[model samples]
Target: MSGFEVAGVVIGALPLVITALSAYKQGKEVLASLRKFRGLLDGLIHQLQTQKTAFYLDILEHLREAMVPEILQYGDPTEEKCVGILLDAKTGTQMHDYLGPLHEPFLEIFGYYEKYLKEITSQLDYIVRLKDAPKDDLPNIIRASKIQNASLVFKGRLKFTIDRKTLDALVKDLGTERYSLGKLIKRVKTKREWEANEPTSSSTTLTLAFARVRESATLLHKDSLEVPTITVTETCDQLIHATARVQVKSICDDAQHSRNQGRVLALELMSDALGLSEAKHKPHQSYNISTTLADFLRDTAQDEDARMSPLNQTLLALNVVSSVLQLRPTVWCNIPWNSMSIRFPIRLEDDLRIPVCAPYVELAADANLLQSHTCSPKFDHDSCQDDHARDGHSTVGDITSQVHGGLGNKEPTRRHGNIHGPDACCHLLVGVEHEQIIASPCQGD
Candidate 1:
């Protein structure tokens, strides 16, 4: 069979397996031995459903993009009717014509998974049959007069016949295959992004670059803001095509009246931060910013002149506190609150003296790890400890000591004295006291 045929077969088989497991689970009576497999069955069902959905939505979307002519010949690939027609067994010949050109690529991706899919389906089919078999049709030993209890007999028969180890191995293999498929999708996405930005025969104009950034920023805020507007100063171009200095103005009523209200903060796109110039040459290579908040703080600590003025320090502290208060409850707080994740934008000629730009939180590859870390019982104290440890300090002191020690300050300057107390708890601490203003800690127990 062709690779396209094989993919259809595997995807079609998934729903059958899920339905069998779900039906068995809903059966009026379940043997004690079989009950142990409930959790595994449920997990397998969920995994299979997720895999099927990914195949339909993510994998097919990429495939459709790659084979636009073939897909477009039929109808709109994004529409459910078109997707259904492609996956329908009745249209196998039509799909083969459409997918024939991409056969080798599909085979390379899905060929090895064929055996796994077959074995899983076969095993599940057998299990379903076993569940439906009557006592009279069972083997002599299981139905023997010596075994009085039917449940016990069924349990014994299952223990002897079912290989739990094999089942577990199958599930693990399925998970590995799913992960591999996800990586493949990610590669396709990266390729698409690169292709989208590949310089045409014509030189990239500032207007085109601005339009692209505006489109992206609009999509980013489409769900949140009713009318998202991005304002970029034409002259604020350091890396013209690579970076655009844009302001994220607030349309919300409360945000407009907040501190640093109507501020035109400098923006840095992740693509630029990851080095777009180098990315063009080495597409697959992962790049991160060399300078983090830790590096910045260490350099600032050593150079007293580079440190912010008392008022700016107070403002910096206030911004950190405000961001935490505003964003903590939202998905924005799903990040590791360490110094390394915090980053400042590349400074411009007209940038604020105190680094008025909002600090960017660079996400790690494994976002779940950061989320779990943030949700930990001792997250508050532990986050402080992480900052302290990075600065070569062994113990976590009060917010003031943590901040001052991180900055290599022997004593808190009198001008920044008022920044202490419960208000000073934050991931980023800068000391230069303003007497009238009391700053709150960004994170506290």
Candidate 2:
């Protein structure tokens, strides 16, 4: 009896041991796979970082040489053949036609800027504010005072300058029409011409003076395109303090608003910086920020209206710089005590205002960091089951794309819907033509 009972126990224990061993092997495999995935991800992230850093360095490299000189040269009155073109009130269409060849030099100057910007895309970190600071302590329980951060404390709207003389000249020239009385009268019937010619000598005035003048000046043109600029301050201290609770939800929320404002500003800045409004392409769609920022530059910079004033040219260069610098999101890491902080060390500037669009795109983060953080998966909450496939119900994703054929003489554009977030971005393109700034409070969807 004792031997049989011992043998039965041994048989049962063998299966239990095998089951335990299988479980351990499975667990080890899972851990190994996770490590492999993380390693791969780290490599990819490093590659991305390297590529982006190189691009940023390239942009910075062009600073001393490419930016100011090009802008100054483009707007130089001496270089512009049409700058002092006389405001001829007669035959304006003819005058503009004559001045067309003169604007070529200015166009050639901005072409390089457009070309550079087109080469880089989606390599900015918007989360890090322009003015971020490193932490006092590190390698311990990481504190909130060590990460990248940004905030849009409203620096009121920027005032853009208008070229008044040019606008006025254009209006005056287009207003007047030259017509000879003899030719006009000749077009009239013989009877009317005879009646008009008869009152020459009998104490009646024979000649009538008719001078051509502009019918109206009010609608001729806008005085200036308002390129509104705002100051955005990114404190390293603030970013460090804010990154304590950095999560996907928060990043996503910020991204929604920031991108919206960014698009608007990009368009405004491009329009203003490029002198795009006055471009012969007249009220173009794609060149504005609403459609594509980089594409606009590449496409419209070649248009007839792509002639840029020096200020506008500066803005375009500035926009490219800002866009690239702003592409990277501020590095945020979660900390204890419900706090978040920035992970990277950064240099700070005093009350620095970098021009940018609002919420860039959300970033793909580390899984370990993600697992350790408090974030709710973006899934349907009402239908809850342990397995994603097991749940029969479908969750509709948030849709942002809609395609349509645009009006004639217009570029195809993307019309973004209203978004909800704590920080909303507002950009105005028509006024300045380049991406301009505005920081708004976050509102719920």
Candidate 3:
């Protein structure tokens, strides 16, 4: 071959060799990565499967114990039956007790209402056939039917007719079967007023209010708005509180049930990487019950970021409340009057910021950087007087003296960085972190 031809061949061969080497190196690296990834994935999958199995077993066992009677009672309506079973758990009993006197009576009232609705539909079955009748006439029929037993009194300007027998039946059911919620409400209010008027030495009114809050929380039949207003601060807050209580209780209950299942689900999940699943093997116990089905499914997935949803957040809140209440039952038994406001933490809407302060807590829409903190030194709104802060801190004394009319609050001024003393009313460590909203103190502070 000529010199030019030989040089061309050499250059072409060099490039082909280089390309082959590069391809070989890349192939080896890719294979190594795949092996590493496969091992990791296998470990993760095994871990998840172990956890998934344990969680189901633990919760299922608990459900089996808690739900037997409820299952039998509402067997035909599976959803209702499951709910009843959940309500029968020890956690459920704890919830009822926390609610105090409100629990049994509220459930009883709800039971009556359900029956009432059923009875209404049964009595009004005539309307389904009388679909051809004047629509206006149907309202009158329903109204007349409802009032025959004097069960309902319509104040609005509306006219309707009802067959006499249906009306009488409706009235009779109201008078005999249903408890008078109106009367119960009136009695509660009356008791409240009497307690308010009584001497401070008697804590009877506070006790009554505590019971009322519990009762309100358990009221299943009330409108959503009413439920929050009764016990929680804002509507959203009430929802959050309710939801949290439920979920946390489930997790705890599930943990407890895991013993019979050989290992707790949460711990089993951790063991997959740790290799606990291989250590113990037991007969697969069959469970007829399902507890926290939503959580069980989600936990087995590969996605690590997939967490308990908003519903789960609610459950967490409820569980936290339950845990706190179980630890401190007396917290709800009495009112802490020293604080400026009382707010129960509940989430009603997304992005709603629920405050831990009292109902009267307010922030003016237009104000400078104003911060409110729960203070120390027993800050009862009614008892505070001016000049209380000036007694010891002489540095700020000049400012006090220069003022023509003194500052409104007598509770000691909390300068920045002041360590809270034991006597501090709010027991709050006031800082930029604790402050929420730029609020102006009300006239009374």
Candidate 4:
């Protein structure tokens, strides 16, 4: 049978089982054996009624929100009407059209109950037959049988009798099915709630934004944008925050435009100003950085000719640019972009040191000191330049100081080794290694 027909059969048989149990109860006075089984009959009837209520009412209540008006037109979503509409081949297309994703799960739930109900209905039918049997035959029907004691029939054909063991097994199987059905119902309810709350538009917009950012970072360096995986709760909160910010900004803009046109809109304008002031006054959240690019290169320059290669320097520059591009539009961009802000994560393998040339965006508590300090190459050049000159080579500190100094300069200046601009500083740094290689042979001679 089709799943719809099976569901209908199960629903139809439940009432029959309940009626049969009730009828059998009426025969308790005639057969003394029947009086002993009264509690079993009552329990089975109660369980059948509960199952019927679950199918007819509880499941329908959860599904009602997703159901279409066309389906409701058939009648209230009682078990018989629900199954009748599904059973109709004419309404088959409507089922999928109206139910969408819920159609399959709904059918699967019905299919599960249908499997357990077949056995239940058969056992109840046999009990009903015993109610009509002559008094002598009824005694034989209630006889102690070894089959009931030999083993348990959890799902298969049940041997019916007035014996406690057989009836207990039947009740146990019913309880198992009830537990399974309850779990399925809970699952369906959870799925429905999730679908209702899913932020489709906000998720799509955030995904697109992240994809663009990743693409831009990839162009600079493949591993430049290795962001940690955020938890689902965190991601959802971020999306909600972003969406609310956009909406609030849009509303404030509209209100300002209206005010400019001589219409007095006060509440939204006041809210917008308050939000900006609150965000501006809030204390910056700080995080510690193990080693910045400037710190790493300065430490390496202390050793003899331990300068980073030109290629690695170029890669580091690209990574810094990528990090700046990603953070520029966010709240984290409050600090200036300088050598101290560009971090390098270190890794060791087999006594070989590998430094990741990516810029870590976490801001340190002493970050304000970096902004307040004057950008002067003199201090570092005095300390490290003598070491480089003694070794017949320039230190990596010279390159870093020059680049960061250029960044700090508000206008192009002739000081700092006559570097015209930040662009010139970058160009000069790129060729520093090549100049060292050429000067190496001449110095040896």
Stretches > 4 Å off in candidate 1: 31-38, 67-109, 126-162, 177-180, 192-445
Q: Which consecutive 10 residues in model 1 have the weakest lDDT in total?
A: 241-250
Rank candidates, lDDT, best first: 4, 1, 3, 2
Residue runs of model 4 more than 4 Å from their true location after superposition: 28-38, 68-70, 74-79, 89-112, 123-164, 176-183, 199-445
Please give the TM-score that candidate 2 achieves against the real structure.
0.16
Residue 345's lDDT within candidate 2 is 16
Q: Which stretches of candidate 2 lie over 4 Å from their true place?
A: 1-243, 246-294, 320-445
- Tell me the tens digit of each residue's lDDT in model 1 across 1-445: 5455556555545554566566655652566435666456666667778777776665566545556345556544443334344455545554344444543565565655556555554444323223445422312322232345555433221221236676677677667753456566565557657767897533355345456655555544553443222222223222321111111111121223332344332322342221112122211222223456677667777888887665555555445543332233333345566567666655434443333245666543332433332321122234444544566643223333554343343243432332322122322322222111112112222
Tell me how candidate 2 scores on lDDT: 0.26
Question: Candidate 4 residues 234-334, lDDT tens each?
Answer: 11333433333334344445455654565433231132122222222222222223577778878767765667665545555555765565445232245
Q: State how far residue 163 of model 3 sits from its true place (Å).
A: 10
TM-score of structure candidate 3: 0.16
Per-model TM-score, in order, reads 0.31, 0.16, 0.16, 0.34
Candidate 2 lDDT by residue in tens digits, 1-445 = 1221221222222222223223433444556634434333233233333333332332222222223233234333321112112122232333223324422332232232222212111121111112332211111101121233425211112111213343344233322332112222233335445656777542231111111111111112122223222112221222322222122233333445445545322222222122112223222122212223444445446866665555555555443433332323332322221101111111233643222322223223443432232222122221122122243322211110000111111232311112110111111111111111111211111
